[model samples]
Target chain A: MSQAAAAPLPPSHREPRTERGRRTHRAILDAAAHEFGTRGYHDTGITHITARAGVALGSFYTWFESKEAVFRALVADLSAQVRDHVGPHVAAAPDGLAAEEAGLAHFLAFARQQKLIYRIIDEAEFVAPDAFRAHYETTAARILTRLQAAAAKGEIRADVSEAHAWAIMGMNVFLGLRYGIWDDSAATTAVAQTANSMLRDGLKP
Target chain B: MSQAAAAPLPPSHREPRTERGRRTHRAILDAAAHEFGTRGYHDTGITHITARAGVALGSFYTWFESKEAVFRALVADLSAQVRDHVGPHVAAAPDGLAAEEAGLAHFLAFARQQKLIYRIIDEAEFVAPDAFRAHYETTAARILTRLQAAAAKGEIRADVSEAHAWAIMGMNVFLGLRYGIWDDSAATTAVAQTANSMLRDGLKP
Candidate 1:
């Protein structure tokens, strides 16, 4: 789980004033994820998002001023969604190391169900560089915090740092890509167990 | 070093047969790496590469048939360059575990010097999906081979599998991006040592 909402949306984006407005805002963002995920940012247009969203053209413009604006919001939205989905699993785990495994397993499941998440986030690298950087930086920071908490409790190594956090994040991201999005032949539970064992014992025989 | 040349140049690429031809071929690839790395594949043109290579347009045609062809070759070349640059260091290390640290330290240095490597290889994710997959698959396979060898020798955990190889690769890749490409403030050896400690001792307190 990460703090995707750490960065606030820019003032350029209009906030919803009513329940109906919020639903419309969310609908457009969901549609944007699908459109941008499938067609890519360069190929996707505002019309494509509006059409898929089943929202009026006026509504998209009501929340987002342009394609770039909505794309940025979509990245943030997806980041938050992953956090929401994975946070509980991590919280449920009994320890810091177990939390890592639980987080990864749930994340893999989420990735499988929402494969578009990868495409949208990966595309953000070129489409919205700032959001892309923020996503990873924020995610790594969260991992570092958890590691520190674990160390405080004497649950893990005492010398954990930002580097360890990034290393774990990298491991989770690639493992998710390979097993979750690319192919689902391997069991997510099994994959997580293998990785967590390494987390537990390194490579010692 | 990885044998980038192990893969045959597709018939589309006209291999150079003479010493001067080989020099010309090498120059064009180096130039393409620069152009594609800087301008990106879509923005880069054959003329841009030739101009940068200080070679005639005819010379480009003598080697690569099209921009896509050259881009494919460039991905392979970069993949090979990383392997070659990092391989000797891994070889010099006394054990499988030490080899990983050596490989990562050298890889960080290579990434710092060849920052475009990340951009080019990343862009290949979209431009040349096959090449991008091949680059990682081959690299992972190499790591898996070493891990299996180490396991056989009882130098590491007996259960080290492809998952472990991918995990280590993921760690190295993100570490390279954060420390190598993004900033040079952190010492490569220090960063590698931190990660290697995790590999050597897990996260146990």
Candidate 2:
């Protein structure tokens, strides 16, 4: 561990001014995703990230002050990545429930391709506790917003609240872990449809 | 880090034979839970565990061989603790959905009291991957069996499968994190009842 890593610093203290600087910053983050995703936080080093990014040590310092900063940034980046990847698919759905199904299906697909997303995000609970909480809080809040919109449109129950959003988010997260990360043998659409059915119609006999 | 911790040993390779021995073993595990739960795995040492347990160095070795062994055992122990804590509440419910409601309510209470549980279990993902997997796998399997039983009893849809089980487990987990670990301001029974309503009836208005 580097001495710089010991002192906590703001993750995004510096931003790229030009295209070349932006490219270098992006490369460093992408490389960080791979290294932190694979080697984990304790084992991974700034040199490992720089080596993988093919950037100079000075370039890393210019962008990120320490290992912790890059990791915190990566957590936020991955959180945004999930939102970007699934947002459009969700928006395309005709109704709120359908939007959920679509969001889950796309999330499963994203998890399969970007398997490291789970590891990176999960580790944030310890490495960057605030970021971890923010990710779920943001995701659940988004779900709540969608649910409220659906309720206003008379598409779903009028009593939709924060708890409902949390429940749905939890269901989607675990389903992604089981079908997406643990095994890809199961069809994503089929899994989504099954869960969506339960969401669409109660599990009554 | 001790050299003994480097070698992988069966978590339960040595079992206490006498009453006195069993008490000593239990004390060590309880102490380990506190140390590992608070300090985390890498930061904790054997002496830390022994001192906390009020046992001598030899007493620590009498039951477990290394730090890794105790940590693995702790994962399994915590997993069992959750099951033992929540099982009766679930079983005592009159119906399938009600059982889920009861399970969540009790689980929330358990999380609030044993706050260290989330940290220890979450850390197991990196420290003891297999044990972490086993914990969820076993919990999901139990949920599946309950769903199947409920289906047979005409309490739920006939098609309740592993997917449904995973979805419910996910809901409970995230709900626990939000309402249980993060903030206990919300009444657990209220959260469980709201979630149960969704499971009992579809989200449709």
CAPRI level of candidate 2: medium
Give residue A25's lDDT in candidate 2 (0 to 100): 88
Error of 1 at B49 (Å): 0.7
Candidate 2 docking DockQ: 0.54
lDDT tens per residue, model 1, B1-205: 1246224445558778999999999999999999998888889999999999999999999899899999998898899999999999998899989999999999999999999998898888788777887788788888999999988988898988888988899999999988998777899999999999999889989
lDDT of 1 by residue, A153-180 (tens): 9999999998999899999998987788
Candidate 1 Cα outliers beyond 4 Å, as residue runs = A1-12, B1-11
lDDT of 2 by residue, A109-196 (tens): 9999999999999999999887788788878888999999999999999999999999999999999988999888899999999999
**Model 2: per-residue Cα lDDT at residue B204:** 94
TM-score, chain A, per candidate?
Answer: 0.94, 0.93
How well does candidate 2 match the true structure, expressed as C-alpha RMSD?
5.6
Please report, in order, the local distance difference test score of every candidate based on alpha carbons.
Answer: 0.88, 0.89
Q: Best-fitting candidate, measured by DockQ?
A: 1
